[model samples]
Target chain A: MKLTDAKAQFISSWGAFGTHWGINRTMAQIHALLLISPDPITQDDIMEQLSISRGNVNMNTRDLIDWGLVERVLIPGERKEFFTAEKDIWKVATQIIKERKKRELDPMLKLLSQLEQIEGDKKDKDVKQFVDTIAGIRKFGGQADKVLDVMIKADENWFLGSLLKFFK
Target chain B: MKLTDAKAQFISSWGAFGTHWGINRTMAQIHALLLISPDPITQDDIMEQLSISRGNVNMNTRDLIDWGLVERVLIPGERKEFFTAEKDIWKVATQIIKERKKRELDPMLKLLSQLEQIEGDKKDKDVKQFVDTIAGIRKFGGQADKVLDVMIKADENWFLGSLLKFFK
Candidate 1:
């Protein structure tokens, strides 16, 4: 495949993948474009390349920055803001994991804790089942929380090496 | 909280959580309902409880079954088919991991492999960056594939015990 064709394919596929994971398609495509670029790009460049509106680019870029996966880059004597994505895939993965843990898992765990305290007789089948389910989910979420904490803090070499060894 | 109110809250939250992760709200709500039910429930029961149409219940239940998180249960003398979710939270988690790995992660890795073969001069900065990004993602995806494989096959006690020790 030619480089340009390959790049287009990657961007398109990443967008589709993002939709499956609850992210907007245009946002993922912009991220994909930035990921493969050798230099930081302006919003105008992104708009032209992705064929998206300026407002769309503006919104998605802000979200990407919020996720800590992309950053604003300043160019000397340049009026327009430029953006760049973190190129290291490991760091990218860790950043996503960290944010999702905070946004989704932590909240779910809190809800489970509250649900576990529902007033009911333990002998009732409905009560027993509810408590058991909540407790099980809470325990699993707690374990995942700890595991992700370690991962977000560890460097690539130590984390992957230890994981490879342990899993092996 | 009363048992009914607690159940309502759990169902609502689970549905909301599912939307964040790209699962449909109705499907997750049905799964949540089945998870906490001590006995198998019929499609009509699900429709009445969740205030959804019969078609919606049928469609989402089929999807849940496809994901291996829920199953059809036949009562000996009943004419209607009943459904039940895999109530073991550990098993539910592993099943989802397994299905997503097969559906999404595996295909992504395959695409990355092909993208890695894009023809380009290595000295060109764009080509170099593209190749590097693809290669980095492939390596990380490969590692995750292996880890998820083990997790899918592992029993809960052993897997969680090992992960806790390893991460600690």
Candidate 2:
């Protein structure tokens, strides 16, 4: 419960959780440090707290900013850039979902669409079989996308109210 | 958009995403394959479809079963385990969250608690400072855990209702 012990433990656990969510360990740890600080924290302070090298800190900070989960803070008289995490956990989760869909989901959708145009499958049994196989996957992927879209855009109370519908 | 091109692209993108997700490449590809199949697929079929070694197919299939994302469905009168994915995307997401929390969150919580109990300076300035820093992190981690607990309880309607409230 002591302050110093608390800081180290926070950094360590945040780092471990990062890998599970497809993030680098150190990146999440730095975010953890920023989350609890009452005021903006400078890069120099971060380096000292986490005991990481300058380059590693710089790269991961950039990544966190890119993910829209952390932001730079400007102190009126301060020269060094300070950082803080996005405080609303729900918003943080939303930003992550949107970004991942844009980066990962959209591309897969485009690829699946393009595959539907392939020809020559009727001329060869093997080619036909391969095409059939891919068509199936494309169908599944599209369905999955629709499911994500539906979950995201469905009316308020959709998740709880429709639980029985899905079960049936 | 040729079927050939589409299949190739799907395999590659899915595999890349899997690496980020800690599922590795071949394992994800195999999962992708099974997800779309109209018929029950055997281990030999998986190996051929994935173009992976028999051992790779054997290992990843076991992993899929372990994760509860994929199941070894038995044929009516056959010996080989026919594989299939849990096609419900909601169920898929839930399983992933549960397994990941077990692998990443639970262990980190224990570690953080252990690190928090480490004794430090009661009177020394630096000792007091260090301990306070770690404590701040532990508090943040606890807050994060609270958010995740609510998320674990969420279903479709719960997600939508919460998002609507938060959005407004």
Candidate 3:
């Protein structure tokens, strides 16, 4: 396959993959472009390559940076910032997981704690049931958080390598 | 907290969690409701409990069924279909992963294969580079799919047990 066609295919597929994984399409394409590029690509390059507007590129780039998936690069004799993505696929996935957990799980853990503390209405079966369920979900989420912690640590090949053996 | 208040909180939070995980809000909330209920909930119950329109309830319920997270339950002497969720949290998570893989990964795999078959423009550096990058992603995604396949088979306590050994 020709390089240009391959690049387009890669970008489009990666963007679609991103949407499925809960990231926006454009954001994923930007990351994919940066990921495979030999050099840091400027906003103009990304815009030209992806046929996206400046604002869309800027917003998604910031989001990618926030997620620890991409980084900005400075070119000598150039005023515009260039960007590159984390090349290690595992690290990219790990960072996405870690950041999402921090954003989604931490606050949930706190809220569950608060909900558990609320006094149930003894006369109200519905209220009692609701509290009990929240309390249960909190317990479950706590365990899931532990699993997340384990997965994060397992980013090292040692854990996966050992585990991959058992799958056999 | 009162039961009504607690129910509202749980639904809202679960819906929020769903958004992060690529599941729509109403679908997740409905599942959350079913998870906590002592009895199989009817369509009316779901619509009422969620305060959603009938069309919204029908659509998301179908979606949940398609995802294999929720199922129809028949109550004696009742023709109306009732709904229930997989109670075991581990099983619930496993089904989610399996369904998501089919929805997201399967399509990308096909697309990657088609794109890879595109005739190469050997003379163009750009085309050559692009093809190589996408082919690399195809390799990466294929490996990911294999890893996920192994995990999906380790249902419920089997997962925890395997993960225990994997992380050991």
Candidate 4:
């Protein structure tokens, strides 16, 4: 495939994949575009290339920045702001894992812990099942939390080399 | 909190959480209901409890079963087919991970590998960047695939005890 066609295909596929993982299509497309770009690009460039509305570019760009996956760049002697994605996929994954752990996992684990304390007789099958389920989830989430912490702190070599080896 | 009220809260929250993870709310809600129920229930029971259409319940339950998180239970002398969720949270999570890895991650890595072979001038910065990005993602996906394979094969005790200890 030609480079341009390949890039377009990659961007669209990445966007579709992102949708299944809770990220919106446009956001992932924008990230894909920025990743393959040799230089930081202006919002107008993104709008023109992706054929998206200005509002969409602005909103998703801000969301990406908030997620720490993208950054705003100011060119010397240039007025319009530009954006760039974190090009290192490993760091990008780590950042996403960190943010999602904070946003989704931590809060869900907290709720599960509270639910486990629901006042009930242990002898009641319903109560016992509910408590057991909650406790199980909390324990699993806690282990995941620890593992992710280690990954976020470690470099890609350590994770891909040491960790993967150990897991294997 | 009262048992009924607590169960309602758990169901709603689980459904909401499921949305963020690409699972539909109704499917997650059905799973939650089955998880908390001490006995297997019929489609009519699910419809009544969730106040959803019979068709909706039918569809999501089938999906849950397909994901291997829910199963059909036959009660002797009972004409109706009852359903129950895998109450062990560890099993439920492993099943989900296994399914999603097949559905999303595996295909994604395959695409990235194909994209990596795009005909291009290696010296061109854009070509280099595109190839590098695809390679990085493929590597990460490969590592995740390996980790998930181990998790799928592991029993709950081995995963929670030995794996957690090794990672820690």
Off by over 4 Å in 4: A156-168, B156-168
- Cand. 4 TM to true fold: 0.93
After superposition, candidate 2 runs with Cα above 4 Å error? A116-168, B73-82, B87-94, B97-168
DockQ of each: 0.61, 0.21, 0.38, 0.59
Task: Tell me what fraction of the real C-alpha contacts between chains A and B each candidate also makes.
Answer: 0.78, 0.33, 0.40, 0.71
Predicted complex 3: DockQ: 0.38
TM-score of each: 0.94, 0.66, 0.83, 0.93
Docking outcome class, model 4: medium
For candidate 3, write residues B76-127 as lDDT tens digits: 8999999888766656767887888898887888887877776755466545
**Tens-digit lDDT track of model 1 for B21-136:** 88999999999999899999999999999999999998999999999999999999999999999987777888899998999999999999999998979999999999999998
| Candidate number that wins on TM-score, 2 or 4 | 4
Clashes of each: 0, 23, 9, 0
Q: List runs of model 3 lying over 4 Å from the truth.
A: A121-140, A154-168, B113-136, B156-168
Comparing 2 and 3 on TM-score, the stronger one:
3
lDDT for model 4, please: 0.88
The best candidate by DockQ is: 1
What is candidate 2's lDDT per residue for A87-135, written digit by digit as tens? 5544555577667777777786686666656776467654564556556
Would you list the clashing residue pairs of candidate 3?
Answer: A1-B120, A2-B120, A2-B121, A2-B127, A3-B126, A3-B127, A3-B128, A4-B127, A127-B3
- Poorest lDDT segment (10 consecutive residues) of candidate 2 chain A: A159-168
TM-score of chain B of each: 0.92, 0.81, 0.85, 0.93
Top-scoring candidate (TM-score): 1
Worst 10 residues of 3 chain A by lDDT: A159-168
